[model samples]
Target chain A: MDKFTVLSAVAAPLPEENIDTDKIIPARFLKTTKRTGLGVHAFDSMRYRADGSENPDFVLNQEPYRKAEILITYDNLGCGSSREHAPWALLDFGIRCVIAPSFADIFHNNCFKNGILPIVLPHDVCTQLMEDARMGGNARLTIDLPRQVVVRPDGTEVPFNVDPLRKKLLLEGLDDIGQTLQHEKEITTFEERRAQAQPWIPRIVLD
Target chain B: MAPRTLFDKIWDSHVVETLPDKTAILYIDRHLVHEVTSPQAFEGLRMSGRRLRHPDATIAVVDHNVPTSDRTQPIEEAESRNQIETLERNVKEFGVPYFPLLSARQGIVHVVGPEQGISLPGMTIVCGDSHTSTHGAMGALAFGIGTSEVEHVMATQTILQKPAKNMKVVVEGQVGPGVTAKDIMLAIIGHIGTAGGTGHVIEFAGSAIRELDMAGRMTICNMSIEAGARAGLVAPDETTFEYVRGRPFAPKGEAFDEAVAYWKTLAADEGAHYDRVVELRAEDITPVLTWGTSPETVIPVTGTVPDPASEADPGKRAQMQRMLDYMGLEAGQKIAGTPVDVVFIGSCTNSRIEDLRAAAAIAAGRKVAEGVRAMIVPGSGIVKAQAEEEGLDKVFLEAGFEWREAGCSMCLGMNPDRLTPGQRCASTSNRNFEGRQGPGGRTHLLSPAMAAAAAVTGCLTDVRELI
Candidate 1:
């Protein structure tokens, strides 16, 4: 993945609340061991017509959103089940930033780990963004991860704040497991303490 | 300085030791395991050749892949049968207590724990599932852990942790008729915006909370994860003690009084402060329905699907369009009369006896929709047996709905009973995410009675009419 100071691309709007993880990436896709190649299956039910074609009315199938990287949604986005696959699928589908009135807990953490910025704006502000995205394909929005700014096509800039630790990890592409492992030296020292304190623990080599 | 709250007491007691780094080594009092998530953790333990630290404190059940409607026959699916078989083998080998699918104790882990009195106040619990917070209603400090974390607890009886910010979500006024705990939670989700409670432990209080039944309080605390809170709790009181008094694992006789006396000391001080406090008016809530591919995309059934275009936040608008598009819904469309094919009324969230009664009450004289498949799965084998003894099973069966055994059926598509592609379902199970039930399946989340109502009507109708 390339690091870019994201400029005005496109912002598509979907105002329904409680968009859960299953809808973001359904369960069947979950059976696969590999997390890659989930983009095609993302929102398969709604994105495709019953006849197995793209739903023209879908925001993704519409104009400027064809190249959209930023998405705006309604309240409680990513509500319901906690499936990390939701963020993985969204990231694979090219969604770099999601601005919502709110996000489900597990999904919010998943988003940050997968390098998707979930910006929570107030409900009134969310309503305004939805209108801008509804203008169709030409509606471009800029998401500058470096500056934590979500800029609108109208030259308006909205700055969002994330936990500093998480921001650094995401910028450096360090997931939770990755973050924990990055301190291999410290983890090893802790393991030594564990071996000394709870000697019953079966010794295993990390390397 | 002010005195500690119940949340602080529970959290402080669980903190075993602070590491050189700031994180705490939190000891787990009870560890709950199920078929799907447990397999890997057990495998990790086997690979490391570590005996479970305290087998007595660990409990297991076969739920996710267990069929609720027909346990009389072998699971036809090779994979499902294998998973359950593996769990049975693993439990036997490890000498761990397990609630097998056909056992009288079997059901969803969350519901089973509380009903068995396994979830107690002032205890720290961990499950390999997110809804573990469901036990918080009993005033326990509980949360879900991942596969590896599950193994860590199994080996050492503790998990690494960081302290959470405190939040108090207080609900006032009396909840009106047709407004159950489910409605209060949905309304709160709407108010707090899902992630509003992230990194926080939410204490649900005030008059309305005090009035809720045990099952209702469990339902509210169960979805705390949905609000991004690490846990949700209600201060233990008479209602809490009454529910815990005579359960199989709860204290009895002399022990009971001693437990209650100790429990009272854990209550929050009158002036204990919180990092955040969000208030909700109970009277404002009604039976709610979710229209989007998410949980927070909920509105009253009578309300129209949202028009995201009118939202002021550009970031939120784009996300809203995706939700509406993925849900195959248009802005401002009525949620009612949206036809559904499957109606599932069971999960860790709402598969308890109270939930079953609510669904059965709505189905008493109603016939299910022509093509909709409706299932009422109790939360556990005990619940199933009790319901049958009380004839609640017959009530649903006579109503043209299938009365199934207890398990985490249709909550997630880990089992054979799942929604087919593009099938719209009215599910009482939490999570309305697309394909959550199966590939390309659409889920509309609702309460047990609401799901039953949808089954009867084959559309998204409010349950108030029948209830």
Candidate 2:
């Protein structure tokens, strides 16, 4: 994972609300163990027609939006499924920041873990961003995590707040597993005490 | 100190270490794994040269990818076969207790966990699948985790979690006959909207919730995720104890009694404070049907589709318009008698034996309407055999319903059983997302009895009418 400090990229506006994980990447595409090829199938049903031709009217299928790296959507984005494939697909599709009014908790957490910045702005601000995103390829939105601001193509900055820990992790490119391992000693002590209290639980050795 | 809610008690007890930022390394007592999410987590562990910290604490099962038809035949979908095969290989290599495809113990991870007694009162349980909240019916503090967090739990039997806010949904009054837990759940979600419980774990309390059987309780908790809640729970009581008494992993005799003594204290204290509270009258609950994409886009079977023109918020009105357009339903149209192309009566939600019996009772002596494709996939191999022992399968098969093997079939359509494009289905599954069953498929989430009623009528029909 690369450290996510700042990046400037074209913004694509998907103005719909409740764009669920199933819509982000349908369940059928989740069959693969590997994560790389999912970007092509990201919105499988909506992006492609029954005959496998691109749905020209869909947002991502349009000319400048095909190269979008920031997605500005509406309320409750990533509202269903715990599949990390949702973010994998978004990252694979070159979407680094997803600005929405709100996000489902699990999907939001998964995004941070996978190096995607899920920005939760106010409804009005999200609307503003969505409108700005409509500028297509010319709108190069810059997301600066360290500065906590999203710079629009016109040079105006919209400030955002992120959990200090999450921002630190994102900037350092650290996943939760790496941070959790730092508490190994405390965890081992807790387990030892727990095993004493609950004798029914079996112990396993790493050989 | 403030009076602690049941959620606070369980969560606080599980905390191994709480960091300055409020993230706690919560010890997981039981970790449930399935085909779709665990493969990559296992791959992560292998790549990092770390072994499972506590293999015994974890249970693996094949459910999501397995075919519900033709058990003996090789899975035709290559990718689906590889997913299941990868799980088998990973579980074998990791030495975790596993329930392979068609094995008696194999089933939906959510169902098998509680049935096998791996889920118990006061335990912290998690799975890579969101519906892990199903185990919370056992009075456990359970929620779903992503693949990366799954690997965290696999390696340490712990995952870092921030505590969730507590919301108490207290239901009073007696539920009417033919109304089940599913109806109550749908009524709740319909009232609260899809994102109502986003940051909270809901405790379903009061006389109405306590009255439901274990299976009914499970059904309610299973869909908590659909309401955007982390989990839902009912306090452990006699019904819970009786259900767990002699299961494969339940404690025996003296141990059981001691466990029961502790479990009694797992309920919320009289003066416990909840961050949020909602009250409902059980008698008000009716057979619910989702007319549109989201679970929150639900209405009573007797009610009409919501008119977007009636919505005050412009954004919400547009959202409603999109939903109505996609569903091919007119505003103000009645939900009942809306034609259904298919009916699916199985999933982690409403796939227990009790759920089957309810649908079977409805299906008995009635034939599915002409042109309606109806299927009943049991939740697990054990459930399938149990349904057959009671001749439930025969009743369904005779009623023109396809009695398939145990798996998540047509619920999100990962398998061969699916609704074609533009087809509409009345399903007993949790989600009603657009294209959830298949590309351009429409789903109406309802109870098992309602689904059975839809099958017989070839439309979304109220179970009360038939009963």
Candidate 3:
């Protein structure tokens, strides 16, 4: 995981709501065991035509936006599927932050784990940011994690809320497994107690 | 003692420890793995030189990319075959119990978990697939997790989590004729919108919910994800106990009695408080279908496609217009009588034996309308065998609907069973997202019986009329 701090870059605007995980990366491209190299296939259907040519109409395919490190979208973004590939693709494509009015629960959590910041703003604020994003590479947005604000191109700052622990973890680039391993003794004790209390909890017997 | 909600009881019992932050380390009792999501997690473990902490607590199956066609033949697609092979190798290396592609028990992870009695009452279950909420119907605290979390669970047998808020959805009154659990769920999503249940765990209660069988309850809980709920569950009762009693992995004899006693205590205490409460009358629900790409874009089968012009919000109107354009539907057009090219009757949401029986009952004496390709893929091999024994296969075959082996065929379109571009379908699958069936495929989600009705009529016909 990469540490996330302050990032100032061009933000692409996709005002559509309910941009599901399938749209981010279709199931067809999910066959790969490795997570890297998915940026090419990110938003595969939208980015490419049926004949495999790039769809120039897409926001990400347009000039300036093609190198965007931030995304501004509408409500319920990333609404379907729990596939972590959605965030992996975004991170692989160099998108470090997503500003939306709302987000689906699983996708929101997945973003924090992958070191991508998912910021929730009011609908009006998101619409305004989307407008600001349409100005292209000239209007770079600054996401200051330590300060917990999104700095607009016009030098305006908008505060956002994030879980304190998640925010801290993201700044340090720490993985969850390492944090969880610290409680190994407690987990072991809990398991022993549960085994005695709920002996009927079925265990897998491999053939 | 103060009253406690069902979620509170399960979550409290699973807590291994609480960090300085409010996040609790919740011990997971079961972890279900599937092909599409587990491969990367296994690779992570391998890269870190970490051993699976509890192989006995995890189970793996290949479903998403496995061909629903002849299992005897080699998989034609190299990528799909490689993905399945990767899971096989990973599971074997990790010493995790696995149901191979050919295993009679092999099916969608959610379907197989409860069928094998691995997902029981008062347990915390996690899967890489979003439909893991389906197992919550078994009175378990089950929800979906990402691959990173999957790796975390595999390494520590627990997941770091902040407890979700409690929500109670109570559906009173009996559903009218032709209204099934699918219809009820669709109605709930339509009423609540896609993000209504976000950040909360919903407990489905009331007379109508209690009246549903285990399969029906599973169907309702399965789509709770579509409503944006973290998870949904029905309290354990005689129905849930009866379903688990004779299962292969369920506790035996006296152990079963003790387990049932514990399961009985898993329900919410009387006068328990909920953070939010939503009440509905089941009688008000109708046979509903998705008219657009999103699950919440649902309307009664008798209704017309919504006109975006009527939407108050400009942003929502634009989204609706885009959905209409992609679905090739005209505003204010009738949803019923819209021609369909295909009918798919299977998925984790509605591929159990009961769902198969419902579709078969409607197809018993009718033929699939001309120009329509209808297929029934059972949920699991066990379900397939049961349907065959009950002669449902003959019914479907005679009705011109292809009866096929069990897997998540045409659900997420990971397999060869898919809708061609520009094809319209009446499907029983959970999602109706753009290209969910296949690229340029338009999906209208409904119940199995409704899908069967559409197959016979070659259109999105009202199931009540056929019944």
Candidate 4:
């Protein structure tokens, strides 16, 4: 996981609501065993035409926005599926932060695990950010993690809230698995106690 | 002491250690794995030189990309075949118990879990699919995790987590005929928008919820994710106990009695506090379906398509307009009479034997309307065998609905079954998202009975009228 501190980059605006994981990276592209190289397939359905050419109408297909590191969208962004590939695709495609009024629960957590920042802002604030995004290259947004604010191109700062622990993890780029492993003894003790209290909760012995 | 919710009790019992910020290292009792999500997790474990901490507690199956047609033949899609083969090799190397495509028990991971009693009361279950919430019907703390979390569980048998606030969705009174659990869930999602249950765990209660069978309860909990909640719970009771009693992997004799005793105590205590409460009358919930791409874009079967012009918010109006265009529906058109090209009656949401029976009852002695291709893909080999024994397959086959083998099939369209561009479908699957059934496939989510009604009428027909 890459450490996320402060990033200043162009943000792409997708003004739709409930842009689900299926649309982010279709199930067809989910067959890969490895996580890398999904950037080209990000938003596969909308990004490309049926003949495999770029769909000029898509925001990501446009100039300057093609290299966007932040995304601004409407409510309930990433609303369906628990597929981690959604975030993987976004990260691979250079999107590091997503600003929305709200997000689906699984996708929100998936974003953090993959080092993509999913920032929930007020609806009006997100609308403003989307407008700023529409200005293209000249309107680069700066996300300051330590200060917990999104700095606009006009030099205005809008603060946001994130879980303190998750915020720390992102700033440090710490491995969660490594952090949890430090309590290996406690996990072992819990397993032993659970075994005695509920012996039937072990393996599923199929006939 | 304050009263604890069922979710609280299960969560507290599973805590291995609590951090200062309320995040806990939670011990997972079961980890369900599928082809699409587990391969990368396994790859991560291999790359890190980590051994699976508890392979016995994990179970793997192939569903999403498996061909639902003949299992004897080779998988034609090269990428899909490689993915399945990758899982087969990974599970073998990792020593996890697996139900391969040819196994009699192989099916959708959610269905396979409960059917084999792998998901039990008072356990914490995690899978890489959002529908893992379906196991919450067993009085478990089950939710979906990302591939990173999957790898975490594989290496440590635990996950990092924070407790969600409690929410109670109380649906009172009994549903009338033609109204099923699927209808109740759709109605609930409609009442609460797609993001309504975010950051909370919903405990579905009240008289109507109690009246539902185990299968019905699973259907309700299964779509909690669709409502933006990580998990949904229905406290375990006699109904849940009865369903688990004879399952192959369930405990035997004295151990079963012991388990039931503990399970009986897993319900929310009296005077339990909830962060929020949403109430509904089951009798008021008629046969309902999704008219647009989102699950929240639902209305009763008798309602007309909504006009975006009536929406107060401009952003929402534009979104509605886009959905209306994609759905090819007029602003004020009646939803009931809309024609459909396909009818699908299977998925983790509605692929159990009970769902099959409900659809077969409607299909009995009724011919599928011309130009409508309907298919019934049973949830698993066990479900298929059970349906056949009850002659539900005969009823569906005679009614012109193709009786297919188990797997996800048209649900996610990763397999051979799919819809072409601009094909409208009446489906029993959980999601109605854009291209969820296939690229350019338009899906209308409904109950199995409703789907069958659509198949026979060649349009979206109310099951009440058909009955």
Candidate 5:
């Protein structure tokens, strides 16, 4: 998981904007403790017809893109309710990066925290990329996680930005909990101050 | 140097400490919890072996993941059952008050909080959900936090965070016919991009806000989180005090008078200063319908789908094109009467008695469109029971719509209810993200009455016009 290497072939195309998290992984899937294997149920509705057969019309069913690691999407990606499962499912499905025009504030932040690089480009750029991916399964895109550069097959590069702090944490694989632990000394100091300031409160311990 | 606004006063007073990293340690006065996000925080606590530092300050309710179709069985789905059970266990273990499914007061946290007088002026409330900001309408500072932060607040009644700049949005003039607080909010978000409220605590004042009822004020404040603001607030005035005077949690008699006197002090001074001020005329506001994705994608019902080229700002135009392509929407199309296959009229956004009454007025003696699947999911079991008692359920069913039990139903793709793939819906829910209702499902946000109108007319139609 730390290495975060992904292939170009497993990419999928979301035809619409605001691809919400619930759609990526339904709420039922959230019951499980384990985040892995969500890929099997990812886009379950799109993958299955009313008769439960594979819908070839869906982008995931198309050849070559079936195993792609990058997903090309339109603007306002992940626009619905803030469900963390959306990013969890995307990561579970082997997608390390998503190229889109824009993203919802919460979902975009959630994706970054969970180790997915949400690449926001201009609309024309996204359209061009989506068209490229659709024209052939041979089209490839690479997101160098460490470098934060989205490298297109045509040698065109889109330089994306991330919060400097979040970028550092992502490269080091630290979540909010992990980042808090990094400031363990400061937290302890604060806790000590709190203990004295509010002596009536019990010292609650957590692992 | 100047008279402080309620927003500035609240922002300054709550800052316990400011860190080098720019996060402020703000004290929390109240914390509300629901079934979904509370479980993990509770587990995190037990794993760490910590007792809730001050359980009395926190309250828990089971709202999400409850069955909307049936009141009994703790929900048929095992996972939903487990989610509810987990809450019961956590509340028991944590010593927090719990409002279970059948409780008479059980409702959306926002509705339940203000109605019960648990949300009070000058209180800093936090919940594990975004709409937590709805409490801001009472001159309280409230916001949504994550699971880890939930645990943090449970252990310590204070949150470590950054303070926000103050934004005053003055909504002036009288509202037009059929315009509600929902339309005002939708109009606000449409004018300012979703991120417009980023890093600001928006304080709504002016004639329009002052004229709104407490319930209507809540509807406006509820969607403040949707506008990317950390929170939105209204000063405690007569309307605010009257709404809370007789609630279960409010103090009685002279105690209430004392509390009201104290609440009045929390309002902004006569010459309050604001970092940013936005003025909107209420008369100019109209019923809104979302044409594309995102809550900010909303527009006046009289408008058309914005053409990318029509946008003068090149960057904005570029962004619009991206959103359009991703949403699979064509530019320059009229938003009204766009075909819809589903109509949902309940959620935390618009599931109060007022929301139900508004939608029912539109649905009365009318039939829902043929072959269109329309459902009304009450936000809480208590609301559902009240609606049924008043025969609102019959009104909904008479309109060819299904009246379901309380839970977050079609607003999200949770529970058994969902929009079929490729189907479009005019939803009263907050978000209009693609596939938010179901896979390949298209959602267009509208007011409850608008949703009801769409259900009857079989498309995104304005109710005020139909009337």
Candidate 6:
């Protein structure tokens, strides 16, 4: 994962609510072992038509929005399923930030783990951002994580808040495994005590 | 000292270490894996040269991608075949116990874990699927995790997690006739918007919840994710112990007694503190039908579509309009008698044998309405076989339903079973998100019995009326 502090990019507008993981990347495209080549499949059903041609009405297929790096969406974005592929596809599609009124918990966490910023703003601000995003390629919004502000394409800015630890981890690009290992000694001691207390509990021994 | 809520009791007991930042390293008692999400996690394990830390504590089941139809034949979809095959290869290589595709033991991961007694009280369970919360019904701290976290648990047998705030939903009074757990769950979600329970683990209690059986509790907990809760739990009691006593993976004899003794102490103390609380009267709950894309956009079966103009919040008003447009429904139109193209009754949420029994009871001596595609999918192969032995399949087939094998059939449309574009269905599944069952498919969440009612009427009809 890459450290995320400040990003400035064109914003695309997807005003639909409850844009679930299955819509972000359908289960049919989830068979790949690697995360590469998933950008084309991001929003697979909506982005492409039954005849395999691009859906002209899809915002991602429209001019200027095709290269959008910031996505502004509605409430309950990424609402269903716990597929990590949702964030993987978004990041692969070059979307660095998602602005919404609210996000499903798992999807929000997955976004941070994959270096994508999911910004939760007030509903009115999200509405304003969606309108700003309709300005096409010229709608460049800048997110400053350290300062907790989203600078709109215009000079106006919207303030936001994030958990301090999450913000630090995002700024430092620290993976959860490495951070968790910092307390390995305590974990090992606890496991030993638990194993002694519950002999019937199962454990696996590595050779 | 405060009397901790049930969620706090289970969560605190599993913590190996806690940091000043409030994150804790919690030991995982069981990790369930499925074909859809485990392939990538297993691949990551291989790439990192790490072996599973606790293979005995992990169980894999191929459910999501398996074809519910013609199990003896090879899976026709190339992607589905590859996903299932990769799981088999990975499970074999890791030396982990797994139920292969079409195996009698293979079922939806959430369904298999509990039915086999692998999910126990006072344990922390996790899977890469959101319905992992279904295990929390057994007095456990269970929630969904991402694939990266799945690998973390596989390699370390622990996950770094922040404890969720505690919430209790108290449903008092007895449920009226024809009301089921599915109806109560929908009512709860509608009461609290989709994001209301965010960052909280909800414990279902009170008289009505206590009256529910294990299967009913599972149905409620399975949809906890829809309410944005980290997990849902009910204190383990005699009903729980009886359900687990004879299952294959459960402890035997003396061990079982000891486990039950421990589980008996898993309930909240008399003055337990909750961060938040919501109360509902069971008599107030009714058969629910979702009129929009989100689970929260629901009303009682006897109600009508909500008019957006009546909404106080501007954003909510806009959302209602969008939902109405997608659903092709007019505000103020009654929900009942609204035409339905299909009736699907199966999912991790409501596909257990009891769920099947409810549907079968309603379908007995009735025929599905002409032009309606009605199907009943059992939760597991065992459930299917048991239903057949009890003639539940006959009841369904006689009613003109397609009696299908187990798996997540027509739930999220990963397989061949799905609705076509613009099709509207009355479903027993949890989600009603846009295109969840298929491209341009509209879903109205309902109970199994209500789905049978819809199948017979060719419209959304109140099961109580039929009864």
What value does the lDDT take at residue A117 in candidate 3? 96
lDDT of 5 by residue, B43-98 (tens): 76777776676676788887767666657554777877887788888788777887
Could you give candidate 1's per-residue lDDT for residues A1-207 as a string of tens digits?
233345466777876766666667666555433345777877766688778899998887777776678778876677555555676677678788889877766567657656777888887888788787777766677777779887776879878877666566567764343333344465445545644643322111111
CA lDDT, candidate 2, residue A29: 90
Q: What's the candidate order when arranged by decreasing lDDT?
A: 3, 4, 2, 6, 1, 5
RMSD of each: 7.0, 1.8, 1.0, 1.2, 5.7, 2.3
Model 3 chain B weakest lDDT span, ten residues long: B403-412
| TM-score against native, each model | 0.77, 0.98, 0.99, 0.98, 0.79, 0.95
Candidate 1: which stretches are off by over 4 Å?
A1-26, A29-207
Candidates in order have lDDT scores of 0.77, 0.89, 0.92, 0.92, 0.75, 0.87
Candidate 5 — which residues are off by over 4 angstroms?
Answer: A1-28, A33-80, A90-207, B270-273, B306-335, B385-394, B397-400
lDDT of 2 by residue, A6-97 (tens): 98888888888888999999998989897677899998878998899999999999978898888888888998898989998999998888
Candidate 6: C-alpha RMSD to true structure equals 2.3
The runs of at least 3 residues in candidate 6 whose Cα sits more than 4 Å from the true structure, single-residue gaps closed, are A45-52, A131-139, A154-159, A202-207, B312-314
- The list of candidate 2 runs beyond 4 A from truth reads A201-207
Tens digits of lDDT, candidate 2, B1-467? 67888899899889999889998889999998999988889999999998998887888888888899888999999999999999999998999988888678888888888888889888999999888899889999989888888998999889877899999999899999778899999989988887889999999998999999999999999989888898998899999999999988877788788788888888888799888899999988877888999999878899999999999988789989989998999999888889999999999998999999999999999999999999998898888889999999999999999998888889978988888888999999999898999888899999999999999999888789898
Count residue pairs with overlapping backbones in model 4. 0
Q: How accurate is candidate 1 locally (lDDT)?
A: 0.77
Best by DockQ: 3
Model 6, residue pairs in steric clash: none
Clashing pairs in model 4, backbone N/Cα/C closer than 3 A = none
Candidate 6 chain A TM is: 0.95
lDDT of 3 at B295: 96
- State how far residue B285 of model 5 sits from its true place (Å): 1.5
Please give, for residues B1-467, the per-residue lDDT of candidate 6 as tens digits: 67877888888888988777887889988999888878778887888788887788899888887788877898998988888888889988998888877678888888998898889888899999999999988888889998888988988889978888889999999999899999999999999988778889999999999999998999999999999888999999898989988888887888888788888888999998899999999999988878998888879999999899999977678878978988889999999999999999999999999999999888999999999999988889888889999999989998899988889979988888888889999999988887788878899999999999999999999999888
- Among the candidates, what TM-score does chain A have in each? 0.83, 0.94, 0.98, 0.97, 0.82, 0.95
lDDT of 5 at B383: 71
